[model samples]
Target: MTNIYNEINALEGAFRKTAEFETLKEAVEVVKADEEALNVFKNFRKIQIELQKKQLAGEDLLEDELVYAQKAAQLAQQNEKISAMLEAEMKVSKVIEEVNRILLKPIQTLYEDIQ
Candidate 1:
């Protein structure tokens, strides 16, 4: 209930950070794909499957609880993606720093030659 909602909110908040969001998103996707096999989603799947059938028949889910869970999924996905992006960014930054260090050695050599 409240705990679920809080996790949803935190995921949403971290959504914009691409690396984190990607990481979170992958986790969320995995959780969703296995929800049918997972205990927590087992009970809900019955209703969810029915809801999907109804939706296909032109009826839609109108309950706030269902919507909240869906939102939680999206939020979690976004957070995962953001986390991933951050990690990638860190790696790229490190690579750039290393490159700069290597390039400076050549510049130093050239300066020494000029002198």
Candidate 2:
């Protein structure tokens, strides 16, 4: 078995001679890639928030449309009631005219007798 102290020293010497390991510039570039990936995640999160806002806006629009439809239907019903009332008023006016004609016979006879 290899002596532990000798192996440790030999590994240290080999690391000192190796320049192919991570240099300062290569390590900085790796850190920049990590930072850029983090920014991409942040931007994606912002897009998700914007999408949620748009969905809420769409829901509000649909609600407003429903409200308007309900108002329009109510107005239509009110107009129908008004129309029915007008028709009843015209019928009453016709009845009144007929009653006047029927009652005019005795009134004219009295007026002629007085004259």
Candidate 3:
């Protein structure tokens, strides 16, 4: 039988070498080089994480928090380096989503067969 862990590790290595991953790495480095951009990105990420946590905990999002998040997002978009990094991140996310779908095919097929 094939070792699933080994296969997963191999997949991870291959994923790291993909163009999307490389672009994201470069974009991150560019953001890191720009202090202002990095600060904006970090602030946005912090707000995002806080909002996500609140959502996961079943707590309501306050108006101020939503407004802050919106403003942070707008600020992040205004920073060229941060914007590039976000775009690169989206590309990497798409690749990961496709990989996840591919990996779930066996389970999906099994469920369909049961139905």
Candidate 4:
């Protein structure tokens, strides 16, 4: 029988070697080296986390908070390093999502025949 844990560990190693992961690493380094870009990225991430927390708590977002989040996103996008990092993050997330779908296929198939 195959060792699932060992297979997962090997998949983790392979994931780190992917081009999407490499691009994300480079983009993050570029953002870190630029003080202004790093600040913008941090602020945007902070806002994102705060908004997500509010959502998880079932609270409605205030208009001003939404506006501020939108403005922060714009600022982050205007920073070249941050924009590149965000793009790289999206690419990496897409790859992870595909991997998750593939991993879930067996479970999905098992449920498909249930009455």
Candidate 5:
């Protein structure tokens, strides 16, 4: 069996150079420049992760945590820097998702043939 590690590395470098990734990087810098916005965003992410983990574990979410998440979402919506960063992040995620779909097409077809 052959490994495509080098090709994967090359694709990683290429992905970084893509326009989507570049825009995401710029958005990240904008967020980094605003300390308060960055901190708020970080807190929101932490809360989001914690909530998701709880949900996946079938644990009930605390009322305080729910309120905090709501407040965080509102604050992020009002913050231009954070909104831009989130939009850029979504764009990058979409690009990566499309790339993965494309890369998996051949494997998907092989599976279909076996079925």
Candidate 6:
């Protein structure tokens, strides 16, 4: 049988070696150096987590919450450091999401076959 743990470890190593990871690290450092940007980024993440929880629980998301997030995003975009950080974060997130989808393909195929 294939060693899934080893495969996952290999994936982790590959991820660490990617340019996206380096860019993300640099972006993080830039954000860390800027107090205002850091605060805005932190607040944005807090709001995002709250919204995500509500969405996950099947609760109705209010328009005000969306507007709040939008405003936070706008503010982040106005600051170059925060904007770069957000972009880097999005790139990293996309990479992880794609990797996860690829990893789950086997299970998805199995379910499809069973049904």
Alpha-carbon RMSD, each predicted model: 19.4, 45.5, 1.0, 1.1, 1.7, 2.6
Q: Write the per-residue lDDT of candidate 5 for residues 45-103, one digit (tens) a residue.
A: 99899999999999999899899899999998789999998999899999889989999
Q: How does each model score on TM-score?
A: 0.28, 0.27, 0.95, 0.94, 0.89, 0.78
Which runs in model 1 stand beyond 4 Å of their true positions? 1-78, 109-115
lDDT of each: 0.57, 0.51, 0.96, 0.95, 0.92, 0.90
In terms of lDDT, the best-performing candidate is 3
Cα lDDT of candidate 6 equals 0.90
Measured on C-alpha atoms, candidate 2 has an lDDT of 0.51
lDDT of candidate 1 over 1-42, digit per residue (tens): 378688757755654455644554554455556544343444
Q: What's the true lDDT of residue 33 in model 5?
A: 95
Best by TM-score: 3
After superposition, the stretches of candidate 2 with alpha carbons farther than 4 Å from their true spots are 1-78, 112-115
Ranking by TM-score: 3, 4, 5, 6, 1, 2
TM-score-better candidate, 1 vs 3: 3
Kindly list the per-residue Cα lDDT of model 4 for residues 3-115, writing each as its tens digit.
99999999999999999999999999999999989888889999999999999999999999999999999999988888898899999999999999999999999999897
- TM-score of the candidate numbered 2? 0.27
lDDT of 1 at 82: 36
Local error of candidate 6 at residue 16 (angstroms) = 0.7
Q: Which portions of model 5 show Cα errors greater than 4 Å?
A: none
For 9-78, candidate 6 gives per-residue lDDT tens digits of 9989999888899899999999998898899989988998999999999999899999999998788799
The candidate with the higher lDDT, 2 or 4, is 4
